[model samples]
Target: MKPSLYIATALMLASTSGFAQRPPAISSPDVHADNTVTFKYYSRTAQKVSLSGEFLSGNHAMTKDTSGIWSITVGPVKPDIYPYAFVVDSVPVADPNNTYIFANERFKRSIVDIPGNTPLVHALQKVPHGKVSYRLYPSKTLGTTRQLLVYTPPGFNPAGKTKYPVLYLIHGGSDTEETWTKVGRANFIADNLIAQKKAVPMIIVMPYGNVRPAPMPDFTKEVMQDIIPFIEANYPVLADPQHRAVAGFSVGGGQTLNIGLTNTSKFAYVSSYAPYTQTEEFQKNFGATYAPNAEQVNKQLKLFTISVGTDDFLYESVKQNIAMFTAKGIRLRSDIVPGGHTWMNCKQYLATTLQGIFK
Candidate 1:
């Protein structure tokens, strides 16, 4: 059977709109009952069109039919939702057929929803639910008030009888505290993991890590001194070092190492997802330097993990950091997943890393 026919059938089964809506001018080349999905786009004016996404095997170029429609079939894709866009004539464009969308940095892309039952989707079943709170806090370091989001685990309540461990999750540059919960879906991942008995129930504190305005100095200090103290004081969380973990993505990952390592007594576990190991510009601007001997720093860390995708633009620097840390007798779990530096890879890292945390 033709691929478009399969997609049409699958869409009919999944969507309530039925076949009443106008069919996409360019239909998917293939769809599977097993949850595989194919996408097609017609751009007669374009010389070439390619599909690029974290879900595909690679940024594979789609075959263009004589009619000028570009298409590719990928799957059976995992059940979890996937973000993707098409490159037409080297220009990125969202799928006209799908309405699902997600924010990536400043850009937005169309998303395809796969069935949750599919193995590709991470198992996020009925985990102990968590509560998310949004608030404004004064930052003495930044000399301004900043908005932040906090996620307390299922049993989180000041009136409750118990205190919970805390995970300080920082966002990357160009993102805010909402990034972890909104785009990264950290709460959902945590809920699912806890329910699956994969991780210990803990509170997650997501704070805005960026120090806005150009030439901002000492961003890490602001996070450590200002944000950490505010959260610890305001929330019903364990204040001890053993119960504290700090992690982040990209620039935020660098901040995690800088803030967590320098304040070893405050955080016991540290994880960096797609972190920049050593940027000369950063070093020059912030006067930050990697320790000559990481063993000295590693000894104080309980768990240190760094992960980056194979296709990530930062892959080289991440590798260098891993090598430096490894040479210094720092036992770090380094993961090189199969995607680029997209949010998809970051989400996967979050799920995998949190599973091993507080174990």
Candidate 2:
């Protein structure tokens, strides 16, 4: 074959292969005007596909098309951000069509944002936005360098005379620091709250709370010794405990109790949301034999609150914890709302916390 003939043959074959291999374009999590969302997944070989999300009470089946696409249209779902996944065969996987993902160590789920007619707190509005800075800090307790996210409110200036208060926020178990921003929409929530003057201009530090392959207790030390000091040294933040707050959800909620309660001199405001307190740390810290100096703790803490949903799995235990705290003469504020241990509830909890804290 001559050179021109060979090149022409190869080009024709390549064009044919490319056309044959290309998949049709499709959209997952197409939010409709009515608030219903249609989710799609392209899989030719899968035996089964189902949609699972916080929006639905149970798993909904997906219908497969002749084009090897599986899809399900779900809900005039309550306007909120939700994590959903397609379970192919038996394994749960994130929607390949959707780029927004739930930031966690364990779950591979995609996010769908359904907007309300009225603006939701987590919705991205035309408000003055804060900046989320990814920073690396040295963690002496963990013997390694760690990453954290800092949210500086609108008009934040490191060189400015206005020093802001700090909120050390922690995510749930298996959730990375980014979960607070990506899934929970903490920055947008803060931006909206601050714009409306509902929340004071402050700095929020979301640290990686999972210290695995090492004892979980080390995270408390890391927060106390490393993260706080790094924030104070690097940012124009209020240094005293009176201007500092600590809060978390789920496993990090348990961590909040460990870190904040133990060192009342560090956090003036401590809030735990749907806290999963059934841990060795919780037992060790607030165990049967452990008795806290309630008066001293009350005096040191400007605010001590625990918020949990009525339908949460940990509701009974949370109620028990509340009762125990009350019995021990510890002044506590409990916000019992209706929902479960989902990120949807997490946003509401954070919004309330923002308004309540640093007041």
Candidate 3:
């Protein structure tokens, strides 16, 4: 009850609490000057921990230390945004120490941005950046409330009279509207291109492109009906075919070929990256319409591009697609690169396609 005695007791308790056991320190993701990144996962009870990502060879087994920390050093990775995760005891998990995250398709992962000596096309350069926003709209065809990620280019003012061109960018199978921006880094690519004045400042709209198992209404219905109407009414964008473009990867690439080719009057620029479609399915679906609309479609469409990697699963089919359509008295542009059906190639395809679209 005495003041001095109570103060001494409080000090002793504070010392005990301060000296109480504390969490161990972490030395994860040690970035070296040579660009090699070493990642560490400390777990005293885990049986196994491995690292896999946009970097490294598939999955690399990390070495465990005496202190129960698993670690691996990979790359000299080229300066780019890479997503990686640590698999602990057969469960895939993001690194807890990393603050940057890129999530899509309902799965979240950690990201690391390695800066290059000079800015890459996909790099986020020091320039006026754009704004990415989410707009939830009612999809009457799908009978669901769908979300779309819209990117307005740098210096975009909705009130101003400057109306920008629009690009309806679509995502692949098992991916959502957010995939293009989050994982593909489409916004930064667009920002860099616009800053360099290689591509025009345009409004990019990324929409979900999965409507599957057949007999179901194709997503093209929603794309043509709900999404276009919403973007046109809300944003300061050009509303004509001359200022509109459509592009996607994988399944979305197929949709691009189907919708953009079939509705050529609506989209002047169309690009498909590693589009997945069987010849039989293509014939059953778009063949009849393609033959009849050939002249009109060709007349209306300014640019029609198809790109696929050499190692892509859809490579042969895409080549056949290019050949089949070209033989159908249609003009086509095909870009075959050196990679597989991965996001790495998709990003490059996007960058190249953007530079050519509005020009």
Candidate 4:
């Protein structure tokens, strides 16, 4: 226990701990001059690795070389920010090599900064940016106050004398009112579309679609009893059915169809992106029987557009919905894009569908 011996022991402990605590090693590929960005991960102990995202065709499985690194070249992707994650051995994980992430209500998404100037993805331009205002509204149906996000176009002002069409954009399950604006970049889509003159200047209302403390409620009750009245009373929007549209992704998509069809007089335009409504609960709740008669229900719908990614898990169900609607004499537009069940597909659909709506 001499002074010199004690000092030597302390130094040895510090050195050992420092070496053991080194951070995990991460390696990322360089962006080529041609604008294509490659990504690589090293997991010598991992049995499998794959990249699952909007950019790839079908969750492209990485090729593990003899050097123990898994790699893939994903591009020419359009010039836009894409959120993606790596799945290692059946487990969903974020990219350790990337620093950017997009936040949602429930979780954080790892993002890769893909410049829009690149020929592969949609590039960001110097367009008029829209304003997203977060507000709280009282909901009688839920018996409580709820959050609502309103996206106003560039010149939106309460004192202004302009009445804008409103699009009610709903998020999927496990998401809140912020999902569409935050993760889906609904405001950005609207901004770009309006700037390019592709879509009319409109106000987008994103409300929390999930009925808390209960299983997903019937869209008929939730939309009819809650969302509709709130929009009509609170905003400076057209109250007419022709100026109103309802759209959603995944579970929200199902809600669009369930609520839009049953209450056709409320929403003139309806769009469902990768909607899921084939369960027995959906049938029982919506009274969605397989009817071959198109004239069975009164059709006051102006436009009923259904879009799904080709690789979506609900692809078949969406196709069946299209066919079922057709057999019933319901004339609708069905779009099958080249992607899967992710925000990328939904974003593209939102851009296009909003352009064709209220025209």
Candidate 5:
């Protein structure tokens, strides 16, 4: 109607449009100098909130303050990276204030890093870094294009005359290809290990191991047929079995047993970490097809190792597998450590594998 009246009304509306009523910013996963961590979550209407993480023995209840913020400070935790989540009224949720996440298909958890005085193997250190590249490859077995991550060692050159060994690494069930690099910090571990001359420079191929809706066993086919050929063709890696290795964690670890043991001529190094072998495919292969040809398999494989944490749920099964291999006169190295089935142990297993493989 009137110019001055319209301007006055616009200003009045803008002032009441809820911008200034926004809640204050909250910081979560605050790591203290003493290695203790403070986790915070903002919720006013929640009945209860609790914290669950690898660092703690059990879920710890969080106290709510007047500002609708629920928080708990736990641990002078042993300096390492851990995945934690807040259970708000029985529902697990990632910290809204923390951006670092645990890369998995089934969990929405946030990551917290408590740095040690010395850099952890998975920690980013002042060393020559490797490049993690995401690449798409055609999966003839799966009948689609799939994505995978490749970690090339520092100073990698495509046209260079030097060729590197290849490690076909796989992730756990419900974990994506990026889990190895993102959650497990495989690239950083490799960087630190290579810089220290503990491990040789090599190429690592992390492929998506889930082929659900399709038979779970088909993943072994994809890795053997599609993924291996793609990496060998594209990267300057040695193609022979002597220079090729296969390793994985959880369900992927079971696949490692299937793919590596059944095809011992293809993979010289087979490292399975806390493998979940209670699968139909694992039984079908290890029971029928495997037939305990331990002598021949032992001859073909240069290194066969299985690692498991004592507190892992699958520890008994893994120990049984180790015993079976030992009884069959197959040479195997067992790395039994203290901890559960977690990415923390995965990093330890990988660091050890890097040191042992391709030597």
Candidate 6:
């Protein structure tokens, strides 16, 4: 064969050989019958890969096959939504093959939901789903345009005569206004609850809880002034204390206590889930002021509740707040359940609060 023939043969082989072939199939988070799941990642160059998530007992090393694909099948993960990531050689990254992801400012994670055979609280069902509206309005308090997410329950019609109560649900730190309905499944929960007649149809208001130029913004001021007024003016809501509730998780939880408790005349039902508070600061400022007004708050408050996980870092601090309020002769309801400051427990607390509120 001449040199030209040889060159043509080499080019044909390069085009048709392994370089053009498709790699092996990767089945990430492959669910099994016994409630186990197999997570797989294809990485030919990585020296190590470890799986880290709420499902495992810390970082678990993945086993590599002959094809250099790292994998791990963890047994019997509980039926819930979990966020996981792969730390390939110490750098964390979401599963490239997985599209479901959770939001976080510092870390990226791939979300997996091990749904029960039946529909869970976060799972979608045949029930009538509510409407989620992303509303934008100018915040006079902050001097900026802000976004808020609102959930209107099934059959909610502003033009009709029926007016529903409102729940101002706040999101956690590192989450945007969309977190509650998008990740926490707030609309689905509301839909399911209303369908079963377990919860009254209501409007859920989710606001952007953060502001610039401070350790924190005057969220209480913004919500009380801007967000509430916007909702009342536009939506078919019973814009009164008896029909208004406030609840939140994490930083939003702290805001809930600070704003809702102080304005007892405005919010009838007030609750917090895994609230983060600096005990010393709370005692120095809020505690002293609110302790004196405990009677009025207790009188006007239809439901005053705090729910925290036993294993949460803020558990003891939350207990301290509760103790202070208890000493002030304020009626307080507590849900000290298992888990930590996580969405798993947030959902439980929200479910419980919805059942008992506005009844």
The number of the candidate with the highest lDDT is 5
Reference-based lDDT, each prediction? 0.74, 0.88, 0.83, 0.75, 0.90, 0.84
Once model 3 is optimally superposed onto the true structure by TM-score, how far is the C-alpha of residue 265 displaced, in angstroms? 0.9
- Model 2 scores a C-alpha lDDT of 0.88
Residue pairs in collision within model 1? 3-29, 78-120, 79-121, 80-121
Clashing pairs in 4: 77-120, 77-121, 78-120, 78-121, 78-122, 79-121, 79-122, 116-123, 294-328
For model 2, residues 1-359, the per-residue Cα lDDT tens digits are: 56675467546656795454434567777999999888888889898899999888778899999999898887789899988888898989998778899999887899999987999999899999999999998898888888999999999999999999999999999999999999999999999999999999999999999987532468888888899999999999988988999999988888888788888888899999988888765677765322557888899899999999999999999999988889989898999999998899999999999998888
| Count of residue pairs whose backbone atoms collide, per candidate | 4, 0, 0, 9, 0, 0
What digit string (tens of lDDT, one per residue) describes model 4 on residues 89-112?
978777766765555555555766
Residue by residue across 154-260, what tens digits does model 5's lDDT show?
99998899899999999999989988987899999999999999999999999998888533468878988899999989999888999999999999898888889
Candidate 3 lDDT (Cα, 0 to 1):
0.83
- Tens digit of lDDT per residue, candidate 1, span 97-197? 66555644676667665654543324344556878898799988878998888887777777776878888887877777877776677888788777777
Where in model 2 is the C-alpha error above 4 Å? Answer: 1-22, 213-216, 287-290
TM-score on alpha carbons, each prediction: 0.74, 0.92, 0.87, 0.76, 0.92, 0.89
TM-score between candidate 5 and the true structure: 0.92
In Å, residue 292's CA in model 1 sits off its true spot by 5.6
Query: Candidate 3 lDDT, tens digit per residue, 240-296?
Result: 999999999998888888778878989999999998776466567777677777778
Q: lDDT tens digits, residues 1-359, model 6?
A: 56675467557756785675334556688878777888998888899999998877789899899998899989798888787899999899998778777755656788887886877877888999889998899899988898898899887777999998999998887777877876688888888888989999999998888654331337888888898999899998888899999999998888788778878999899998988777454445575657789789889999999999998999998998788789889998988999988887877888888888899
Instruction: Please identify model 3 stretches exceeding 4 Å from their true place.
Output: 1-30, 106-109, 214-217, 279-283
- lDDT, residue 355, candidate 2: 96
Where's the lowest-lDDT run of ten residues in candidate 4?
Answer: 116-125
Q: Which stretches of model 1 miss by more than 4 angstroms?
A: 1-33, 38-52, 56-75, 86-100, 116-124, 213-217, 281-296
Error of 1 at 158 (Å): 2.6
